[model samples]
Target chain A: MRNLDEDTITQAVLARHTGAPDARLREIMTSLVQHLHAFARDVRLTEAEWFEGIRFLTEVGHMTDDKRQEFILLSDTLGLSMLVTALNNRKPPECTESTVFGPFHVEGSPEYPLGADVANGARGEPCYVRGRVLSRDGSPVPGAELQVWQADADGFYDVQYKGEHGHRARGTLHADAEGRFHFKSIRAEAYPIPHDGPVGRMLDALGRHPWRPAHLHFMITAPGFERLITHVFRNGDQYLDSDAVFGVRRSLIADWVVHPPGPTPDGGRSEQPFYTLDFDFVLNPLAQD
Target chain B: MRNLDEDTITQAVLARHTGAPDARLREIMTSLVQHLHAFARDVRLTEAEWFEGIRFLTEVGHMTDDKRQEFILLSDTLGLSMLVTALNNRKPPECTESTVFGPFHVEGSPEYPLGADVANGARGEPCYVRGRVLSRDGSPVPGAELQVWQADADGFYDVQYKGEHGHRARGTLHADAEGRFHFKSIRAEAYPIPHDGPVGRMLDALGRHPWRPAHLHFMITAPGFERLITHVFRNGDQYLDSDAVFGVRRSLIADWVVHPPGPTPDGGRSEQPFYTLDFDFVLNPLAQD
Candidate 1:
């Protein structure tokens, strides 16, 4: 038994468990020990510095609320978020590119019919998004549950409105027997990342940007195939090359063509204006661990 | 000018600004935008994950207090602590190696006179550490301030035992005109990184060990040189190969050789069993930021 000091404290604590028989856990712990110890030694840590590091982490935990998660944000800002996502989304092609399932998906979004309006009262460049969900073999996946969430025309989420409204342009829709789904909404705009927290402070200290490109999020699932979480980026957004969260993919970019104020398929007020958004999604089989 | 949705709410709230930007603020914002955007792109983040990340970060903030900082712990556990220390401590040879401060060391530690016993009531191997804090030129820097804090015999920092007794094995010690400093305490012991937080959970998930090797933390400063935050590792700790925070350096290891516990021939308690712990610290001048 070693007495309390800097290194001894770390040793006693880390000694509680040896490498797990499980190879994955063993690898992670091994790498973690090397990196963490190297970090401590590199700085020649002090008691005050150690405590300061603890206090910073404590603040990260306390800053959390129903709407925010500083630790996850910290991880995201530090490249861990993408690393985890990339690590997990390794299915074969023809499967829709799996992206991160962000935290703001409302359990109960206003459900719309097969072709009902998803952007009830929003204003922007109106676009008709039509899509089909299919298995990797190209068979239409009917009755597939699809959750489509996007920012308003102005690039903000409904949750940001708090008391004003909830889940705007965000809701659940189901594909018909043909696996065809269509809805009307406005194009999303690029937005910045959170910068008022410690992640932000660290970023500020190091000098970095936080802009994400425009995109619409979708989560589609069927019983046999895997739950597909993905997004379609606007083809030519200025920040496409430098998305804040790195969600862009070659296949996910859509062809959003402006069609002027043409006649709606149903022949409503034609001159109001609208755009056409078309894309498809392919899902892989589900693998539960 | 866009409306908020769940997807964009994080950015909107994070970028909520105070209008005009000064030079420093602009510089901060500019760099923040780049790195953050790159991080997002580097990982290809999505909406659900983005909100979840926000929520995680919010909790980190909620966990902060004067006694602890979860954010720093997150940074320490994540290797950011050592990264910052390394980037900050590019000193020439002979300077003490800087390291991450752990999660303790509160204010109000009683100041002790030179040659006074700092071991309090804890019992273990006795060691007398004598050091001269000098500049790079080898000249003794008179009137330098030194703050000494260490763990107890049980591999726990004095602050960890809060409510049992206050400021045990932690306090400030100043150097005499010769840049000389001495104190009597038991040789420090090995301990663990705090394992009761999200950091612990991360380690568990990663199958990582939290043990750091044994070492003593030191923060030495004088009028001209940079404030030196460093450590002296116990030579034989088995965990040196894998420091939890990556803080170990080849030069930082020290051997507090075991000898019959005895007082110094300088007319102190020659009867008490004690070991000799001696070292010298040289500091680089603080660089202008």
Candidate 2:
């Protein structure tokens, strides 16, 4: 208990928390309080500005519901989501790098067999995606689980469409004995995240666009390896240089080969122009329990 | 538009606001983004911790309504409200110092005449408060508006009582030509801020008490001078050393003299024993229009 001045209040607050039951919680709270105070002092935050922040946060909270999470969107737009992902995902050079696990991934997507089309009732150019899951040593990891999802050409996920029950442009697939997996879906499209909320308003006020680069969301897991959540961005997408969520990486970007309506790279026939996108993912070993 | 790494994301976020129409808003936002990112970096904040913060903020938002504002409470407990008050109320040494104008003040309180008791329908130890509002040169400032409010002996403001109305223990008053003002109320009682919400949970987790020092709220305004929002804390209160809001200052503390049943210091006789509190407030000269 002390009459704390601006310079001493941070110390006083920290001292009060010395008896916290959890050491990690205490450490986290101390750092949080220090930074929170520093931020306020650094800017000499005004009462009016502080009130504005409170109101803005309340509005963001109110905007969140079953289909929307404005707070997560706020994190993404502020680059915190990506920064945390990078911090938690220090991997070997051969292992796939991770990105923001966006808010649209569903819990249980319908499983599909090899060469199945995931874009049911969705409209877009056909894209054939074939990938192999391997260990860091470049050996195939059979029975690896691949959970994949993406937005349609119209920039909305299957869950976003009203009255829609089935998952579109999303599916679960398994790697075979050779660790090979393939599926057909609509080409990934650069799309704006849900921008009708407070986060969208913030982006608009900042003169920033909300469009993410065209990419496929992937979460790969196998026995004796760490679960890897990553994204494979399409090459030459205009928004790649400025993905709204800052989720793109050079290694994750791959070329999409366009072929005439004929024999495909996997020996499959098609009537219209289709794309062939081939990539491989390497997983890092899981940590000891 | 660039793919940002941890080192570069702050600048990218700041650059997005170059086109803001309001210069002040732009400045505030740029500073906010920088500090926000710096805090995250300093803590090496994890995704789980970030999500916890989001959830805490969301709960705070849900707790706020027309009657409750947990965000303001959050700011007050964090010492931000007092810091901002101190920053904005820089005054000459002679002028009375200011503190936080807490959330309990109500607009259009019933005005009372000098020497009148403002504690109608409120129960507590009788206390007579006398003060003078003087200008820098020690001259009386007639008709300076003084808005005052405080909790009862039970540590509850009138607003907190269900079915209570008419602003008990609160009143508006005007200083006389001689700069004299006096009123009757109950002795200020140390009280815990509303602790049933997220802030309370945080305080409990940090092993901090939620009690504030006993005090009276005052907002003084004159036609020409800057408005002063402040508190007069009880000199010997137990919580003065550890006010939950960090709002106590040495200059604002004053002794409350107790008297047996008899003639009062102001020549007013009473059958019951009462306390007398005396103080003087010096107002800075009004800013030139």
Candidate 3:
């Protein structure tokens, strides 16, 4: 055997994978090996550092369960999740941009009608959310499903509060004949992500905070249109400019207008102050699926 | 708010870390984001593929435990460990080359005298191992510690059969006044790494195996010499050219001379056949403290 150096070792690694029957797998593995080697070289990572990484990854795995996804959190903190999202969702300017589908989402949320109160007494400032699901050509996408979820004012998802109330600040709504949908919920609040895990410790050591901007999670889907998983951030959120997960997009910011105690636009009387937010979502047509 | 495409979003992510006080953290994070984004772009990774990667990593993390280190195995298979090893251990050609410190090492091992048998009744061909510890200038390094461990001919480490014969095929010995040491052990054998976990599944999917070459692991240390972690592969082992961990180096191969059933060179009789392997290790001087 010839003495192997850095470059030849990398080449030897890549060459061994030539027999991978799947082309895509080979491509990904090749790039992954190259980039990983480069990262190690770029940092001159020491053995202790490598062992630390191993321990961190192990703890991240151990922290993961049905409710917590520390690996996704690690990826989010590292900006990998957003990078992958951007690569997959390259679209024209007219369409709504996408972001991370964070780990809090649950499938088959209860469907509600327009103006329905989905907050279920969760505490926060009262807010009215109205949105229209539109196509690229400004046409209504009636029957489009908007799966919405967000943390309560306490910054805890209903899942985190397990026994108190099931699935608070979460629901599914459909666009009407006019491609319009609305619901009532508490105003979203910026909150620190779960940082008690390994990823959290990593962020702290790196001098980065784990706060994501206040926003409502939305996964909108319609027939003949590409599904969009995104968030509607409150305009001028403190954390928007430095979202922990890097999921913020300027176009997804919603203007929340506060109102005096009076009648709501939906013809409902409110005893206390309330807020209203109106936004529109544009979905690109699915590419010949 | 403008819509975010790939480039703008990457910039935003990097910008969020500007407040990091440590310059090294900033540099590492910046390079990490760039390489990660580039890898995704190079592969044009799909959302499904991204999630698959996430799940794979999660499983790898879950498979890790006190005994099993799937992540290190993953690193080894991808040649990252060897790359880092090469980067850190660049040395003159005369100096003995280094390789990975595989996961089978045990601390506070039983110390044995020269010519003591380390393999206690393990089924394999009897072998005499003798080596010398020297400095870069060929001077003997007395009192150097030789921490030795390897799999028996049946390809099982002492740690594997934890309940049967605890701590077999492992011992630590020190160089004598002449920097010479010898030990009795079974012929080292090529062995497959643990293949029952997520890493195993990954190797299977990638059309690869988990077999390492026949070799003995050594960690030599002295007061003024840089620590040397390496392995001596049996010459002509089938897996020498394709070590599962990519840890083989030309200078680390050993020549094992076979002998007929007769009196051994160490003044011992062996009714069955036996072999002898003589090798020397050269340690580089310690770096300035």
Candidate 4:
């Protein structure tokens, strides 16, 4: 404890932390310190670089307020969010895989009935999204509650807007008696994440783009089933192969079929081109306690 | 790249970063990703735990401002700062060792002539600190500039005060022709770091104290020598064995000799008890570029 050098310092830190009352906290912090120290040693980090990291982190913190979360964005961009998602959501092979739950998901979104216009004046091409909630055995899981949200064509969520912008392109709905759900919303479009902050600067310096593929976020919950937080990415997005957040999955990708001005899924007439998407979600049973 | 699992996501992220133009940035990022992913996998970090960590980091960031750097404090408490210091500053067997450059050192401290009262009305027992600057071979390195600072008896730096509290217990002075220097300042005392923030809460949760051993910080510099950032710790401080920041080194400890009310080191009379500490600093030559 008195004369800690580079190699012995890690053990000293772990020794100091052995008194943590919470076993889980102790374990987590132990691994965290070991890996963090190893990272610094492996890089032979200089004082200037260390100070730069400190400055970067402080700026990230200062940039964070009630509306934006720069820390989450940093984690997402680093692929940590995806890794955590993968570790926590190990599901059956047939079930829908989960991805990074982007920072845009909000609680108490305006509730809409099946097939209603959940987009509610958001800017994008008209789209009809149809989906069914099913169990791993392919049987319907009726009345499963679905929380859906997505960015507008301009790549901004309702919260991202500075002023009072009513909720758009996001809402809550429930599957029908047959576990089928549909909603009229905007078509998903590729867009860059908020890149005007420190994280954006980091991405630029790293020669990496901040664009996430077009995707619709979904969070579904039902009785006797595990909660699902995932996204339905559009098939032909150029950024699909290099999603900034590493949130794209092959199973989550589906086609947004283009249609000429014609009858919609709800039997409504359309003068302009629109789109339709049909995808099914399979829920895993909750683990037995 | 699109279907990354927990283990594979690390490689995908590293691969995406391969386009970074800077070789140093590429190397640092590669190691960072590897260690970061290993930590998550080692802990099997869950979604809830990951979210908690994000929130904790956000709080740490929010707590930081122009004067307070919670991130640096976090690094210090976790021993990362010391590890970085040790890694960057590898002195010879006899040269003085470097330690954590605490967050409180401010630039532009009022300069003082030798034997001047640098405390400037700060509260603590009067102490005369005499020290010399020498090379590893024990030859004097005259006129070495020393920047010194320490906390008052209340365990608060001048910057910690909310209002206009002038600089106290800190100043800059230069060694004389014989590499000898002495200044009037306050005796160091064990004190808790700024603990009203998230880091404090974390320390409490880990069943650890927030107190650092009594010590005075010093940064010495001269031509043709490496800059040295170190501390002169009191020999018998209770917290020395378990400093909250892991900043204590055996060689840095020195005796603070107590004296009765009598003539002081500056040939001045003192009606109250005082202390004296004599220390020597050895600097290493600058590394060849």
Using TM-score as the measure, the top candidate is 4
Q: Over the stretch A1-289, how does candidate 4's per-residue lDDT look in tens digits?
A: 8999998999999999889999999999999999999999999999999999999999998898888899999999999999999999998899999988898999999999988999898999999999899999999999999999999899888888888878989999999889999999999989899999999999998999999999999999999999999999999999999999999899999999999998988988999999999999999999898
Which residue pairs show collisions in model 2? none
Candidate 3, residues A169-215, lDDT tens digits: the string is 89998899989999999889999999999988878877789999999
Per-model interface RMSD values are 9.7, 2.0, 1.8, 0.7
Best first by DockQ, ranked: 4, 3, 2, 1
Error in Å for residue B167 of model 4: 1.8
Candidate 2's residue-wise lDDT over B107-181, tens digit each? 999999988889997889889999999989898989899999999999999988888577899999999988889
Per-residue alpha-carbon lDDT of candidate 1 for residues B1-289, written as tens digits (9 for 90 to 100): 1222224423432453223244444443333433454444444555455555555555555655666566667676655566556655666766666776666655556788878777787656677788898887898888787777777667888666657665666667889999998887778777778767666666676567778788788777677688877777888888876677667777777888776545563456655556667878888877777
What's the C-alpha lDDT at position B43 in model 2?
77
Question: Distance (Å) between predicted and true CA of B227, model 2?
Answer: 0.9
The CAPRI class of candidate 3 is: medium
Model 1, position B276: C-alpha lDDT score: 68
> What DockQ does each candidate score versus the true complex, computed on alpha carbons?
0.13, 0.54, 0.67, 0.88
TM-score of chain B of each: 0.82, 0.97, 0.96, 0.98
Top model by lDDT, which number? Answer: 4
RMSD of each: 8.1, 2.2, 1.6, 1.2
Q: What is the lDDT of residue A216 in candidate 2?
A: 92
What are the runs in model 4 whose C-alpha is more than 4 Å off?
Answer: none
lDDT for model 3: 0.87
